[model samples]
Target: MVEAVMLWNEPNNLSHWDFKIDPDWKKFAEMAIAAGKAIRSVNPELPIVLGGISPIDPNFIQLMGSHGILNAVDVVAIHGFPLDWNHWNVNEWPAKVDEIRAVTKLPVWISEVGASSFGAEEVQLFGLQRMSELLLGNVERIHWYSLFDLPASWTATTRHKEAEGSAYYRHYYMGLLREDETPKMAAAEFPEGLGICQWFHYEDHRLDSAVEWLHRLKVRYLRTGVSWADSHRENAELWFDRQMKALEPFNTTLTLCFTPEHLGIAPHYTSPPKDPNTFAEFAQWAVSRYAPAPVRTNSAYAMPEEMAAPSVLR
Candidate 1:
């Protein structure tokens, strides 16, 4: 029952991870939005969820909405992984959530969060801290990260056809459940995988993760117009350019949540912004202000149905 596929948290899903898109990276989102639309044309009320690329910041949300994602899903979600692969301190947690809000008006939820042990007590502290923040921040629900400790890292492999089998298994030890779905020592204390959990790292072993998700987005978008695929290519190009530029650090302080390998290339797409909150906020502003000025013509978004308010998932 993979009802939803979304991101975890800022700590777990970090920068080193890259997702590549075939043909082009930017168009990957267009595919998601497009599929959601087709699904909607039939059901008309299914809530499509989008994530697994959020936690870093809200720039992802802005990217999705501006690319026609807002109309695709019923609700948006994100992750908040806080530590590095080494379980080091990552001081920006709540700010990451702010980054999401900076872009779209969609209701949100905290998708993933956990702490791991790597000779640093502070690692677990972050999980406890985030749990407190969630409570204080009025978060409605939060599913703890690892229900068990694998003492190993998450799996890794290069799905990149270009990788030509260059990569191997990745080291990913973080999990709320053991391979058998049993609980780890930390998880045993809290069985449902809620209220906060701990992560175990597999410091060595293999490959990257995001590279696959991101690449899929890019390749799929170019091949198919998932969301706003049918949008005049001119409009998409123009919107993407303006939207990317607008998300720059100027007025707002949200972060820009793009990685270089979003499209499979080193310089594939947008890089991680120094201040994601500012960048994402500014980008949202740009999207709002840059709304295509109505020309005396029949544009794609001219129809009332086309202009309907977007939902969590269409």
Candidate 2:
């Protein structure tokens, strides 16, 4: 059983080519509705969430509401960065929450909020402090943008050379740790006793110390990947069984993200599936393998009862 689903992400950021070319709110609303319906069909109790809109644009939320997107989702999520983006201000967050609430009347989550060091660790620390203070009671939850910084080499492969000079370049330094895995000032500045969650990229799964470090940090939840390319390979079920067994000791809720490379409309992992039915078939297989039911028809697949409901499909 999945708890919740967040459909799409940062739809308001037009820098991504897909949003720039197909910036149709109606089409986006339709897609969100269809995705929500499909998820609910699989697990009716699951809560469907609209992806965080960057900069907390209430006008966009109102537009989504006009197209019935608000009715389809159980929650509205927004992303904010007061220090990097001139369009947003820390002082204005409460009003932005009010604006969104007035339109959607749904629980709002600040799903991605963070500051980048950009060679100024002190400023980043101060920004995080202020962001936390401002958002304390304004939203249901605040999922800070990330847990680790991207390696410099990652930019060369994942982004265009021209992006090196853009505002988006700051993302490479947004993590609690520096690229070398050293703690930054922001890590020390994180508020005491507040629940924190981290996003772990699939590539980092092989790191020996990742889980231990997360446990030390008292992380309650982890948003990680379930790669379709890996699962479709031969003996994939055995591999996943071992992996899940290994992860059981950490005792963290897992939001398993699926990115099917072969089925994607574009070559990129984030692209939508070319055929929804194909993706659905893959999802069923994944659920049956990962859900907490001991060998349901397939003797090779089994998830401990403790592992079932805590793993959400996203």
What is the C-alpha lDDT profile of model 2 across 117-194, one tens digit per residue? 886989789888887788877676667756677677665223345554756578688878877777888877676433
Model 2 TM-score on a 0 to 1 scale: 0.74
Clashes of 1: 67
The sequence of per-residue lDDT tens digits that candidate 1 reaches over residues 173-282 is 34433454443344323322233222212221111221232132221110000112112233444443433242222111111123323222344223332223332232
Which candidate comes out best when scored by TM-score? 2
Off by over 4 Å in 2: 1-3, 15-17, 25-27, 156-161, 164-166, 192-197, 205-208, 221-273, 276-314
Instruction: Please identify model 1 stretches exceeding 4 Å from their true place.
Output: 1-24, 85-92, 118-137, 148-154, 157-171, 177-182, 191-314
